[model samples]
Target: MLALSQGASRSAISRSNKARPDYRGSAFIADIHQNMSVTERGHFMQTKVMSTLNKKGVKAMGIRQVLPFKVLAADKYRAIRNNDSLFDLYGVLIGSCQYLTGIISARRQDELVSLKSSGNLSPNLNPFEHENIEYNLIFKLKKSGNGGKISSNKIIERPIAASIAKIIWRLEAFNEAARSQGLVKGKTLDLFNNLDARMCTLTKTSVKSFNAHLDSICDYFETPLVKMSNGELRRQYLRQHQLRRFFALLFFWQKRFQGLEALRWMLGHTDMSHLYHYISSNEVGDILNGVKATVIVQGVLNKDGELEKLKSIGELKATLAKKYNAGAVIIDDLESVIDLADDDDITAPHIDQLKAEANLESNLEELLKTGEISLEPNFFKVTDENGQVRETFNLAFQVKTV
Candidate 1:
């Protein structure tokens, strides 16, 4: 089944995105059950599986059953996924480097939509540098967290580092396109000085225009992006707000820091309740599974007698859960999942390639003068007082190559 929404593209949600649409949002979930009946392969079968929902009637996370198959066959799926550029931001284009980086985040579109100048992110300069590294994608925000009632600016981690460079790259790409249109510009970085009403990008993409692309996405998945039910509408709202990214980030930090304090600090939420909606018991099993894997891989095989490092799997799960107190990970729940996951030995990837030596090359001073990048010489090892001879980068501009 193919579940989707109408007038609810990621860019379509109002300036104040009301929902968090992810791969698991209601419309997409519903479409999976209520698939394209009139396909070339004869009519389809669908079961209107529904679940209990919140007061405002958001889509319930619990669907009856999910069965995914090749809707277009392997070849067709590949065709769509590969040549998605024609569909641009509608089809697999959502996975494009530009779309992903331009909207570097799903939750903070509003804050990015408000960027008026480059001054918000001052340059980090170094006279002699051998690396391109930036600490953060600093930006001024109106009620940071893209209007979570936050009073100050925000600095969140990038998707996979090089976020600043990627942003500059996209900005340059947009400028190159805009320049061809005779839209008037000295430099796009200099011209995109303000976020106008209904706009979502420095390139001036408006919400009204952005929502129009919803049809293409539905058409590709052979589904309709309409709010026929409260669950459907709620899911649409969530997707617009990019709640998936918000909750995903929270959950990611939850796994990393394994604590509520880390979550509160990163999100800047007033208290724990501000994020209760994103919390759930489903993750308890995930936490346990992770610990279970660690037990089998590291605890059991690494060193059976190192009590401090090799803890009983149960204790490991408990400690991780207690630290990340966002969800309840009772032993009973974990036990049920334990029986299902077949644990076995796994291999660690050989870092033979990582051990290979490589050279660094870039016009550091040129990039600096143009404010096109940042430099962090401290990230690499210099053979001498002169910044040369480095195998890899290790700094905040997030270069973890080695």
Candidate 2:
């Protein structure tokens, strides 16, 4: 069990980062980290999404239970056979979460923007993008979302996209159930009349009333279902958004095993300082247990492991040589290979892109395949001519080349 620092207290944080939406593609893995400050199990979060401090200043304590990812996956599979409203609702939630994480309201816009700029975002395909599946899906979801009157300006922070998508998708299922019960009569403000607008508006309603609505669906749609009062219904169902956030924090820990720097990149943050709340001492125990080590002579010590702009290919090659502990570096171009020595300089503006690929197209096969990267603050110590400690850096942050 991991732990969160004192920063997890609600008094310190103004908003809760409790939602994980699936926005798969270039949004990729860190999409889970977007706007979410995930913490270990011990982290304190408010029970209610919006709550004022009590008389003694104690926020109600309740860790909202969530359907585990595996369970959701199974529910989705079952939905195909059952075609039940509950099952359908579960399926939409799970399906929409495959690549989304942060705020439910903003996901459609991200997809919309990404779709409009796919050419710029992904020109050379990644291993998973053999035929532009992500590009196509973004366009499709954008079209579906536009049909619902979603606004570009209405954005939310750190709530799970899946939960929101579930709510959006669940309404259709609810309306269908109500129709079956002949309850979709006039003047009820049909929740589906303007789906996106209703979605934004519905968040302002009481969770108990919203839950009662779900119970009404259960009574209307399922054949042998039990009914409950509003309070009973609200208490029975876990606070859905909190559960979504719990899944996200778990994802944050899971990704930490893949190297913190990589996780930071995927989240699209300029720096990784914000994620510090999730780290406890030695959380990334022993990453380079079996990696070969050699004397490094020429790499820049990157404390943050951020890809910084280098002046020339000569500088990049020097960094790579020291990082890999090799005298010479080679670039495999299929038909032929180019050898880059420490002193090799480049005049071509395009060729300088080797700096970018240094981190992306790196020799991290072992960690990438295993997802067990260790985070060490001081990877190696640098010595001057007199054997005095000059600089201390971590091996996990070493820059690499293609």
Candidate 3:
């Protein structure tokens, strides 16, 4: 009897131990479901509250403002999903625009007419002023999608609304930056030119492409020349002209205009002609020439040292090519002369052949001592400042025999 009691106790203990883990897992799953249910309920409640507020003619302004029509429509859809009875009422009200249109029945039409005549629709209404009433009603009807339009009309209009909002935001930011920086009002041209320079360099686009981009910016601001008075328009045009000139100067200074030297020369000469035709001919050329000479001298100095290295490399390569003919003048230590080789001539077939023959290895000791053609090393090592050697392998290049 004692042995039977021990076996039963052991079985009970084993069952209790197995049941504890299952209970813990079930508790975990229940907690997850509870959390999801709370989240869904909270969202539904918030949506319902927002819809109620919108129906009461509340307008929310500022950056956080949502369109009333969209908020109400979303709430209606959510209510339908939740099988709420209020969804039927919302559908009926939205659908019954014939009553609002004064065409439902004779009695209802009479009532609507009476409401309009008595100014019940709008108190203190000027009966003679039909324009504003019509405009407001039409605008409201459009917002409510009463013109046989889908509910998604509100969502479709959002991008246009968001674009306008973004423009306002940028204007606010520009105003704040200008105020804090103590920027002068008349220097808009300078500010625009600086922005243009930065954008051109960053985007790596041409001047014409950059100008097209600027047109989009102006369009976003709604600052078209035709919209302003003659004086204001002239000012804007002059500012843009000055901005273009500034960009040209920036391009010239950055050596980007090197590819179009002839165009630069023409523009520099054209400036002199402008002064000559408007002011004096003889003095203009002399004055402009002085300014042009100064710019040229500055440019020459900036480019002089680099120009010397390029000329030296070009002459050396020309001499080598003439001497070697079809044979390769291998530069085993090519990297040492890479800065010189970057000149335009290195792209020539002869120079390319020489580069192809040359072997580039981190460890050039073997080729330097042997003085013969050798394959580049597959791996190399370099000693650090602490005298510890670190090894590296290169798979990009391998030894080839010709």
Candidate 4:
């Protein structure tokens, strides 16, 4: 039945596209084909499916899911280490790598499984010797679709954060351990190879092993179950494809800071329209507006916020107050701003100006030069003469005292 529905959806898309070459409505249909509940697929042939699926798919994890998962995975890995359980440790390590790498690199499962020590997805230790990059995910094959043809295989390298690089290095060490145990021969062909089986590399069929490890970690962590649209609750399993959407959503939100062109290149897309389509139906703008409101409101409340003195914060506040008939009381609170941020009527022209005025990379470079911020593995620490940490900031522009 699922196969028939998938074929029907494909046939429908082909016919619809032929009928109207300019029609792009079927862009999200593939996502729907995967996410539609068994009951929903009964009506899969209906005209409404296209419209509903346009903005719908299996939900991806937000920061809430990602952070806790990371912490839990770390704890589990540490626990397994004490028992000297090599196999269990390997599971946790590979699972964490796959999950985080999916989010960080936005690479498809095929590409991820193809990662090797000397092939695609190679690591660069002395990246700074050439570029300023300390670590990078170098890819030998990129799946860039141009007019439905795969682009030439080229050396595509993306700078990964230090924390992620540490894990990749750990995976290398795990490979060495596996070799010592006679699990494999020389240099491993795949970074995610199954150590228990000699010369066996992880393929698309082997994805469950990765997710099973992730599930164990999440269950151990006692993370909340996700409520599905069908009114059934289930654990939020980190799937391979959802990683791309998660990356697109977060990158779209941060595109004001990091250019869209950069994201386009990182995603291996030949067309900007394909990248835009990824977020068009995904409520990307809504999430970003809420994020902006939170930042601006927090800046207004916290005197020490990174964006506290920005002119746009004042303008946003004033605009919210006038547009929503919100008194000072309402605009001042984070929750109130969140409530107001969803409305399509509220628009802040000055918010556009904020993007031009604030360049995060430049600000960080300046701060580093002036010794106001010291880089850490996970975050930037600001300290005083006594060496007591004053404030901490992450890439998300969040400020907190430790």
Candidate 5:
């Protein structure tokens, strides 16, 4: 019986080896029926084993509890759809946020949305506050556009013409007051104070008006002075000044009579031939020629006599040049004649005699009747060192009306 059992066991081992070569090498499987069961188990384990356990010589066997194939497929489809809709929805939200707050930025939008979601929205916020946020966002975008930095100078510059106009207007008021009321004691101070106060108020009103006017002008020109750089605004202002100067000159010359009908009659139109005669016969000529020469001579004497007289002439020439808008001219040389005179007795008594004759000139009323009341200054010219004659002219008048 022992011989028979040994034969059976050997026969089983031999049969297991023939069926599975790996089974013979392992002590775990011996009996043919147990081996057959183990063989079936190994086949199951091999099919279900994870890749990690296969490498370690250990076979895995258990139910994986995997999610349903349909559920996983549905989740994938939803993820892809969400991705497609996200960009468009984000764009809409960003646009709405920008419209409401007047600001544009992803980070700012995110912050705002976060705030809203967090229930931190404030009802006390005013339009200005909302505007500030918008302004800040715009500023950041502008900075980003310009490489994330802005110059300090560019940020601080503004229109200067309005300020300049206010200053000029104040000066004109002061001058007008001084001219209307003669140089009385303490009157200048009083006039200046009154004008200063009036001008201060006027300046504010004028500036506001000017700003509106400038806006209109800009609109007409299709330009914005406020948005323009400082240099550009300055150039525009200079051009404006040129235009104003031209118009002011025209108005000053045209309104000679200053609303006086009688004065207008006396100063006839340019077309009238008798105008020159009226001016030449006026008593104004006498007062001007008499006192003017004396004043000139005395003023020159107070400065160094001959040299001073030359200086005075030069100044007069400059004044004429400006008035006529002409190039400067050098008249006859006075140096030689001035040198011949004695320093101790430099007074020209003949000048006094000329003054007396000037005083006898006809009155304004008589000159007006004759149509000879010329109030405009005249021009003259003389040869220079190189025999080149130059001409300069002016039309300035200072008349004291009675």
Candidate 6:
């Protein structure tokens, strides 16, 4: 029995390697490192989407849970507002700024800490602006190769909603007041920092301390338990990088408006594939199902409570016939078809399968409108799918002169 179990394990490993040829040799380690931005299980799984869907792993905090942590931070701030210790109040408010800025910018902690007030902050033009006001923050990406030159830095501007910006501004005002009282030294001009005996930059130790504060807040609120990697369970705590992941998730929802290219730029990623590694792939399945449900509810059902002849209906029938090895399957009710699909008994049509066929010209035009895809001249030397230089063709006069 032991030998058989060992053989079964070897067979499973062999099959896994065969299915994912990328994991065949030394490339397996590289792939794991590349996918580390996602859920921990994603290192071994075929795709980040599958790793997220597989619930029996180290789960990260969702947006719903993380949003409440902001509230908890607010409550802590309120509790300490009347305290005599300016340091305590200042620390709490600074932590709140970190949390808010972390989620909004989706930037690394070091980049976030390096934010300057002069070039970065552009307050709203209207003085009467309140909740609707937005402030633009310019982030300067750090480059070791550029010798700390501002001209060589990549600048990314992000507009932050006033509701959150107000908190950051409040912290800035408070820091100024403390500085006037000879509390903090004005050495580092970074937007966010802590005031010890002197003004100091926040480090990795400070992040860990902030996480402990989150853990304590969860204890006070009596939040539910979260599973630890070692099989022990504890209350959920927020991490700086977790905010980056949540921000990526938020960006995915607004992809139709904000688009993927903007997200890639904001995340400081040169490659779309790397940007995708940052996003939670499990949301793709949920969004696809949502599109399916919307089609069924609105497109398939009629105003008179009757089924209409949809292109999806014909497709569903053909899918069912081939799936069951039966001839001429009839779909009388889409509700029944949806139920069968839920039970994994039948393959039903979804929104994606109902869309028109793709054409290069139309796709390129749509992508250009969304600012997601662009064309380059021969000097740029863009390669084809096979990584070879594509031949340039002149179509200005409707002539294929390569």
lDDT for position 28 in model 5: 41
Error of 6 at 92 (Å): 3.9
Tens-digit lDDT string for candidate 3 (51-138): 4333333332111111112335655433432323332322222222212222111111112212211112222233334333321110
Candidates arranged by lDDT, highest first: 4, 6, 1, 2, 5, 3
lDDT of 1 by residue, 63-139 (tens): 22222223455554334433322212222232232234333443344545444333333243321241465534444
Per-residue lDDT tens digits for candidate 5, residues 325-388, read: 5532212112222343334242432332223223322222233233332234344566769997
Q: Order of candidates by TM-score, top first? A: 4, 6, 1, 2, 5, 3
- Candidates in order, TM-scores: namely 0.31, 0.22, 0.13, 0.41, 0.15, 0.39
lDDT by residue (tens digit), candidate 6, 248-337: 455434433234555667656677566544332333223322322333334333534322453434554454445445432223344444
lDDT of 1: 0.32
State model 6's lDDT: 0.42
Give each model's whole-structure lDDT: 0.32, 0.31, 0.29, 0.46, 0.29, 0.42
The candidate 3 region of ten consecutive residues with least summed lDDT is: 135-144
Off by over 4 Å in 3: 1-84, 98-402
Summed over model 1, clashes come to 21
Deviation (Å) of 195 in candidate 2: 8.6
Q: Please write out the lDDT profile of model 2 over residues 1-402, one tens digit for every residue.
A: 011111222333323333433335454367444534333221232223223223232223221211112335655433432333322333333223322422222223233222221121212233232432222121222221324564344322222223333443344455444444433224343322211110111121233433333333333343231122221211122233433333333433343333445434433335546443222211111112112110111122232323233333244445445556663332222002113322334322223233323332343323322332222344345666898774334324343332
Better of 2 and 6 by lDDT: 6
Worst 10 residues of 1 by lDDT: 353-362
Please list all clashing residue pairs in model 3, or write none if there are none: none
